[model samples]
Target: MCGIAAVLNLSLAPVPHLRPALGAMNRLLQHRGPDGEGTWVHPRGVAGFAHRRLSIIDLATGQQPMTDGRGNWITYNGEIYNYVELRAELGAQEFVTTSDTEVILRAYARWGADCLTHLRGMFAFALWDEDRQTLFCARDRFGIKPLYYTVVDRMLYVASEVKALLPFVPEVETDLEGFKDYLTFQFCLSGKTLFRGVGELPPGHVLLARNGGVETRRYWEVYYHPDFDHTAKYFEERIRALIQESVAVHQRSDVPVGAYVSGGLDSSIVAGLAAERQGPGFKGFTGKFSLDPAYDESAYARDLARSRGFELHEVDITADDFVGSIEKVIYHLDYPVAGPGSFPQFMVSQLASRHRKVLLGGQGGDEVFGGYARYLIAYFEQCIKAAIDGTMHSGNFIVTYESIIPNLGSLREYKPLLQEFWREGLFEDLDQRYFRLINRAGVLREEIKWEALGPYSPYATFQ
Candidate 1:
């Protein structure tokens, strides 16, 4: 929703170039936070922080790089859904504005680092403590927002995007391990990023930079303990409640909000919910590719939008458009994330931006629910393996001639990798194997060049 950047001088040198570097970074992210920009120059012995605000909350007064009464400065880039509740709890504190940014500052002032536990929603923020001379930065629990940083020559540089930090760093190099992970898992998993020396602050973690040393630690994780006791009805009720709550929080924007509608169940569900909440004539946006039938899902989107009686804006993207936007997409991404989906996503975002400053997307639905087709394949594979083993209760199967036979045709390209999986004690567990089957691109190793494959091979360890 916004962009944040900070520089901590570990060399203890005067930072005359700090403002210039931040300005360049902010310029790159103007699309993200076009409303306003603010900078905080630490007095004498502290770090500098900058913020580009989109003004979603308390648009009139929620300007940043905001500081508390005690001079503890913070430049926040996120929406804290529970800020109003937190404000109520902090009864006696003299309030300056009705923004979540101030609530975050006050909460940090009272609870210190422990404040992260009580808050909810997506965010990445940098807080500078003048008294302690420490800098604390954190990313949210789900990674909905991004934060990339690098420690070069003992100087800690962080920003909402990697492009912002590029100007400040002397050189740019690829991180081979991260590239390999990207190839293996379409996404650069967790902390690994494509740029050498540049790393993403993993979700639900905090990083502290102090006295030329950096320490990173996790603060939260999603617990996967299966709830076997809950019935289908109970689970549905809980899911509905969570979805409504999440949607409500996401819709807390001062500007008019719109939805991106694809024909898929996830986007359709989001559009439906948004339309219901906002009343009739809600605006929806969709992107259609002219040459790619495999990529076209516009009809479904149009049908859904029509059924909901909402106005739909459709953009027909051609190959030329795709080629022209590739560099811009890569630049905005800060790292290469190879996926056909990103193209349409960017186009849709562009179209949505024309109508609304903020748009709600139906991402994360497939991951949360068992919506992907790969999950179904994994389930079928498990059943077949169980049947072949002739063990009624024992679902696990040992490596044998028939185990890989059925999957051979579809997984032919990954045969060597599959063989290696068995050889190296990988994919032995059912869940791990399932994840591998779902996440991997089943293309033959020879089809893609070694150079092309360089980025994704490291994740093969997990497969």
Candidate 2:
């Protein structure tokens, strides 16, 4: 939602050139924060922090490079959904601004490093502690916002985007390991990027820079332990309640917000619920393809929009548009982290931006629910292997196999799956074989063979 950048090195005062480079880096992220820009350089010339604001909550008062008034300063990106309550809990100290940014600074004053626990939201922030002469940075629990950094000669350069950090670096070169991961998994799995010497501040982590040294440690982890004790009906009611509560809170914006409905079950549910809160002035956005019926879900979206009384906006994207703007979209992405659909999402974002500054959509439903077809294939293979091993009956295997084989026929359309799974490791143990086959970005493509790639490939040594 915003862009934040910082330059830190306590070992030496920041030279005159450092400020220009920091400004350049911050300027590169203007699109992320078209509302306004703020820059704060430590008078001692040791550090500089910059922010690009989108003007979400407190349009007038919520400006970044906000200070705690004791020389400690913060430049942040994100919304603390619980900031209202957090401000109340922090004990009234005659609040100055209504922005969440102030809440974070004050919360840090009270809780120190433990402040991370009291906060709940997506954020990547850098706070300068003038008293301790240390710089503290943190990323949200999930990777909703991005923070990338690299240290060169004790000077730490951090930014919301990897491309923003490029301005401060001497030269840029491909990170081969990141490329190999992309070739295998269609994404970079490691915190490392496609650029050498650049590293990501992993989610749910905090960074402390002081005395010419920086230390980063995890602050939170989302562990999964199924609640088997709870009744199914209880969980169903709880889920419905949570969804309504979350939608209610998110609708608390001062600006008009829109919905992006994909017509999928997940997005429809969100749009439907949000429509309950939003009025007739609410608008919905959807992407359509006139050339492909299979990819066109705009009709279903139209139904939802009509039923929900939403003024719908639909954009029909073509292959030519894909070819033209893909390079631009990937430029904004900083790397090819997403598939071809990213360009459509880019168009969708652009459309949503024209109507409303903020739009809520069911983006991570598949990841959260394991709704990906790959999960189905992986589970099916496990069952078939269990049947062959006599761990499960052959009758169960037949039913599962028959039900799934029809879908597997389309596997030929995907070269990675066929090339990786076809007789590649069939003789190996079931899990082992499937492991080699499953992530098919199952990420197990045979082209990822690193034996002869020598010891230079980071992924090779890593695997």
Candidate 3:
């Protein structure tokens, strides 16, 4: 992954200062892409694009802002799994490099903006067309990568991370509504961000900006389409195939690739699959808390690594490490993220970065599968509500509020709301309420003070 930044001058002023602004933004995102950096400055009255390279693909020649023979420039921050195929289709176009960056330029030349539909990987990118004088930006379908942008005084500012925009636009007003959403949803949901005027590009969406006008459009959505005709075994088979395919595509890197094994079902499954594909003696990494036994899972991780015959590197984190890393983590994250999980993830990434440039993580498995313990609780609550309302026509209750609700401190205050939610059948919709159950922060608008919230409150549809 890499960080991409761009500035489109609506005033049509000379954009000589944009290079330093782009540099400052890129510095904030250095952690995301540490290998190298490149900049594309357009002719006067146009735009500029900057990219920080992580050197994942075509490390020797895949620099940006890569351009076509015709002067159309591109700055991308994602992997295109189909680039190899697209390159063959664009044969004899006087290719300048083997990097996916050049392939992206060629693909755009051949297919225009429609090339995004053929890609299958996590990415956020910006392409500049000097001929049309328009800029195109897009984020991948799953939002595994991120893109944030802001518009001020008719000047369009975009970046792979929000911190990049702060220097150029000193009026970085805190987005209170976004914070409320952040507290409610853990992470800022969908389009809302932590800064006023800055917004995240939703997954599977595209933004086109030209002549001081900007428009956003959706390209994909992940709906819940259950295949009832397929049995549980069929699901397992399909899941295995999908995982293998995803791993194979994600493994396309010029640098060495490794897996983060957390000893949990998801990470272990990913590790196992990767090990099976790479043969014996593949590498895996894990992290554990030294002071907190309850939080430590190193033993399980070690056992799995040994059983699978993989090289395992384990790091033990102490309370001091947590304290020291908190500020840096928050800085790198660009905003306050929910839960303690990010700490371990950051440490794991640091460790993995030492031995391998790219790491395969099982980040999305929990969301895709019915894995979380809270899911079971939510399902049980649904069943209890249905039985209590006589919808199932059963006098027997599966569970009660008293039995289900914990006696933990501060939780008692939410019991009434939880009970009301149960009574009102609020848990009937699994997908919608899943965030409420998992998010440590209360829902935006409801729990957070309105003054602390920002104007982006109404845009959070996922929450």
Candidate 4:
């Protein structure tokens, strides 16, 4: 949605490089926001903030380091979908711009950090309070967008992506433990990254930095506490309501919006709901690998588009595409953490950007609905481990997993995965076993011999 950078130093006078460093960080994030760029330095020359915007909402008047005409200033990314409602709740202020960034500033003034409780959309933002002389920063509930920061030489530097921090702290070197985690888990397992000094702002949390010290606190958190009292019919109605409501609100944009349809159940449902609300002539995009039937789903996408009466666009990617863009992809990603899926996804994103500025996808449906094939494999291995160790009767597993919930046709293609999971007595601990399941990549398994990985294992949680 946007890029944000800030430098705060309260305990010492500002250095000459601090303001220029903010500009360099903003340049590194040009991809995140190409619509506009702005930077502001505090009057005392001790603190500065910068913004790069994609111009999704209030395109004309929404620019940052937006100020309240008072001293408070903010540079924010991602949308606050409920701003229209929030604006009403705040009653009449001067109302200079129709931007949600203003809604955030007023809300903070009225409620302080309590404003986070009223927000509903994905976001990562920094707000500067001149009156209190404090710097406040936060990431959204799910960390959909990212916020990275580090403290060096008593000045705090924060940015939307990790690469931006490198300019200021170029002397910082590799993090061996983080590198080990990336090899085993395919991504940094904790806030610590491959770089030694930088760390991420954990999701649903806030940091307040002042006087050369910073304090971080959790503004929200995620927990699973299942309730069984509700009837099946009640849940069905709720799900239906949520689907319609979410699709309608997420389509809130001054610019054109499009959906990424893969023809899978999740993408199909998302596209179908959007088509119903958006009417005919809506646009959709999909990607396919012409080399293999296993990877090609654009045909199904065509069928859905015809049924929904929306315009359909498709892109075909070849091995050459992978070879050419792999370097750039890894550069933008900062780490090759994900699977080959990122390649095709990038092509599809490029295709969609030509038609619409805003694109939505069913990105997390697999994790949310237990749709990943790996989940079935993981559960089956757990059952086998339980049977051998006499924990089969421990009453720890649900009865539905006993028969492989949705029968997977042929596990022949999945054997390499199973071998990787079961080898090295990996199923011994539930946490370690679960880690293997998430990090399961047959390609990675085949490339890196298990013997070399003997000394390396994943930590259950970030220490």
lDDT of each: 0.78, 0.80, 0.77, 0.82
> Which stretches in model 4 have alpha-carbon errors above 4 Å?
10-12, 92-94, 381-412, 424-429, 439-457, 460-463
Model 2 misplaced stretches (Cα beyond 4 Å): 385-422, 425-453, 456-463
C-alpha RMSD of each candidate structure in angstroms:
4.8, 3.8, 5.0, 3.3
Residue-level lDDT tens digits of model 4 in 1-463: 7999999885847746766787898889899888999998888888899999899888899999899989989989999999888988987566788888899999999999899999889999999988888999989988898898988878888899888888778586877667667775677765768888888888898989976698887888677866567876998899889988998999988988889999888888888889889896689999988799987878989999999899989989988988988888888887666677887888889889888998878888888767666788877776766788887887635523457645656466877777777676666667766766666343465675556434544564532
Error of 1 at 107 (Å): 1.3
Assess the local accuracy of residue 220 in candidate 2 as a C-alpha lDDT between 0 and 100: 94
- Write down the worst ten-residue block by lDDT for model 4: 454-463
TM-scores, all models, native as reference: 0.86, 0.89, 0.86, 0.89
lDDT per residue (tens digit) for residues 1-463 in model 1: 8989988887556566777766776787677788898888787734788888888889899999999979899988888888878889876357889888888888888899999997887899999887778899999998778888998776788888888877766788777777666656766765878888888999999999877688889999888755657677998999888888778777777778889887888888888788878876579998887577888889999898878888899999988888889888877776566557888889888888878877888888878765554554555556566667665355333333354456446654555655544443432577567556644544437765667544445435564
Error of 3 at 285 (Å): 0.8
- Residue 362: error of model 2 in Å? 0.9
Best by lDDT: 4
Given candidate 3, what's the lDDT at residue 222? 68
Q: Assess candidate 1 and give its TM-score to the true structure.
A: 0.86
lDDT, candidate 1, equals: 0.78
Encode model 2's per-residue lDDT on 1-463: one tens digit a residue: 9999998875857645777877898789998999999899888788898889998888888988898788999999988888889989886565799888999999999889999998887899999988888899999998788999998777899999998888667789877777666655566655778888888888898989888788888999978756657776998999899888887777667688888888898888888888878777888899999798988999999999888888889889988988888888978988776556788888888888888988788878888766665655565666667658777653423235556667666555555554656546554555555456534244445755656433554334335
Q: Which candidate number has the best TM-score?
A: 4
- Model 4 clash pairs are none
